[model samples]
Target: MAIPRPGGGATQVLDRSARTPGRRETESALALAERMPRLILESRRVSSTLAHGIHGRRRAGPGESFWQFRPFVAGEAAARIDWRRSARDDRLYVREREWEATHNIWFWIDRSASMGFSSHLAQGPKVERALVLGFALADALVEGGERTGLLGLTRATASRRIVETMAQALVADDKGQDDDAPPPATPGRFDEAVLISDFLSPPEAVKASVDRLAGRGTRGHLVMIVDPVEETFPFSGQAVLHDLESKLSLNVGDAGAWGEAYRVRIAAHRDRLAEIARTQGWTLTIHRTDRPASEAALRLLTLVAAARGTG
Candidate 1:
């Protein structure tokens, strides 16, 4: 699953770092999730305020809006029994309600070596950012009364008991790392599939996985967390580049001469990603390692809101 680089080779890895016990990483992620309700509420309020002049109908709620009709089940609430429909069909049926413009948001993060890059001196690694964002998004979705879960390139779990399992997997030693871990198996009719990755994998592989999810009725949203160094090619003079995943090394001399070419290649890769996302009608956001999690969270929420509008 190597991505073809502009040079006569391919990019097998991006971030390379030893597995270290992340200090307060779990606590930080939990805290961020805890703050998600307030953040989402504020975002909604801000959006409403900003669009005050626009005339639009109020959105329907889960209780008020009728989604569909289902066969009446034993012990079901009598209030849910649709008498009118029963009179017409002469069959017992319950009225199915719809929730308020909400959808189940499943956060899938990539915890591969490429996600361990960090440019900010004081900031956590890209993997940490992915974890925090996933946690926060899941928390927000849950607060909205939408079912939420998390999945990673190396781990996937749905139970609240395993909510932090993905993060733990990231910090675990990869002495016997399994590269064949399958993509997260999603249930039928997923509302949204949010992927946080550097996308170091091949474009075809990534696209195929996304298409599979979309085929299952999951709307895809890709959040690409890239290191600033990777984006800018800031290395100077002669340098030895290492492949984080494969442990391969390349020596590059005269960084100045290669800087422009590297930047062009990176830009092309990004453009290709953007084009793919656009064609799939998926929200694609690029986050830098230097940006604050709060800023990234707001941007992610904006994407979610935009996707909701399209829905």
Candidate 2:
């Protein structure tokens, strides 16, 4: 199945049909890399949908702090012309300000095994949604003059080259070396972080990861990507459940009988994550694959703007 065009309804799904032998049914990392162009385009398309929702940063250009005065060029805004400076010079003069650039905003995408699961009830794999959301947010962030990079794979940068760099990293990230834990190095105090993941790891593990960043004075945003089936647990009758990362298997007598308990556990897990965010003074937003990627991307940008005191 092909990825649905932007604005397509919830039923639209990402194609995961191609796979190498011995690999899971989900789209392999190589297949995903081959489709990077399409993914980036789709991400930009989704971002454009929400672009109108965000206002341009008022102080995005040169800093408001005064620097020097230069002769005003023709057709310049009258307000930009400094009357005091012009009075002392034969030509019109304009006040210039010191340039103030924003700090790097790091994005961490979870490539854990569970993130690759796409239930028949949902749109696509959690990882796909996360990548789209990350790229969409990166587009907006870069457009807004903020530098961005993947947390573990790349450093913060404002160069447009980082986009392709990130895509390459995402496609090559299927080696399974990294777990759901946070990156080892903490971000600088001035830098901001955005973490997108299914966050299916143990609650303690998740807390430890976030706490490590928090300890370093890093204020981050936690974006939880969820599959519709994961949240609803809609399976019924007898079914075998398998762990994506660990190959552990379980025989369920009746999935329906386990739904309520499963939901409760999931809800508790979410609550713990929320509490962790609160304790760290960070923000948390949950995005489901069944929903529009733009929704999450927009919210993530808003959080980024707010964190950087730009919005």
Candidate 3:
């Protein structure tokens, strides 16, 4: 995808020899070997920080477990009224059954080139935190008796070896690694989706991807991973802005002055992202790379539970 010339910045094709693929790859085999072990270890550690078994997988529907007994509302449906429970009370009551069923949650973490970005202020690049949070979420969900998998790439699995399985799926993929978003696919009804990305791509494209994945009554979530520099636009004079996805560089003169307008455009972009999620009845959690992964993990867990509860 071509970079939008924000603020009319002058961009040109970068010379191939200056920073070739050999020099630019963040997923170069050596780096993946170093990051994978930590990805697995940190995922388990982060999952351990959150309380387990909270998801009772409960929703109000047809099930064996009794959810609650509520005062029956006047809707003329006497069949739903519990005559036995009503016998003890002046008001008629209705028996509400909790939906007790295992669920499938699929995750998609952006592995595009831009996700490799970082700055001095960030703890690490965006992908590091993305992978950690993704794996951690999968671990937590599996513990809750829900199946989890990599969206569009792997089948849903509740295996005890979830981390290893997820890691292997990513390791085996040698194509479309540079694509900005998850490829479109259809998941089962009542399935949930978790998408982790920087979301720097065009909003229209992102919206389309969300629309497709959320089809068939599937609910989704958006985890926007950001770096400190992207948040603050801390560039100065005589700077070169490189499009990590496209490998095109822009000579935006006086970047310090460009910060204000840049910030405005970015803010608008983020607003669009939030709007997309809101319209779809989905949730959005913004996770900065510098913050604790546990914080986002906990927030996301709560969201998944809330979605099931209210769904």
lDDT of 2 by residue, 1-311 (tens): 11111111111122224223213544363257676898788887887787665534447545456677777654334676789878985898767554313357788887665666676666877777888888888777766656678877776654555567789887777653346665786677667788887777766777888888888778889998887776777767765555555544456678787767777877887888899899988988999889999888878777766765642
Q: By the TM-score metric, which is better: model 2 or model 3?
A: 3
lDDT of each: 0.55, 0.68, 0.73
> lDDT score of model 3?
0.73
Score every model by TM-score.
0.65, 0.77, 0.79
Range of the 10 consecutive residues with the lowest summed lDDT in candidate 1: 173-182
Rank the candidate models, highest TM-score first. Answer: 3, 2, 1
Backbone clash count for every predicted candidate, in the order shown: 3, 0, 0
Top TM-score: which candidate number? 3
Greater-TM-score candidate between 1 and 3: 3
Q: Which ten residues in a row are the worst by lDDT in model 3? A: 1-10
Tens-place lDDT digits, model 1, residues 201-225: 6666667777778877778788887
lDDT of 1: 0.55
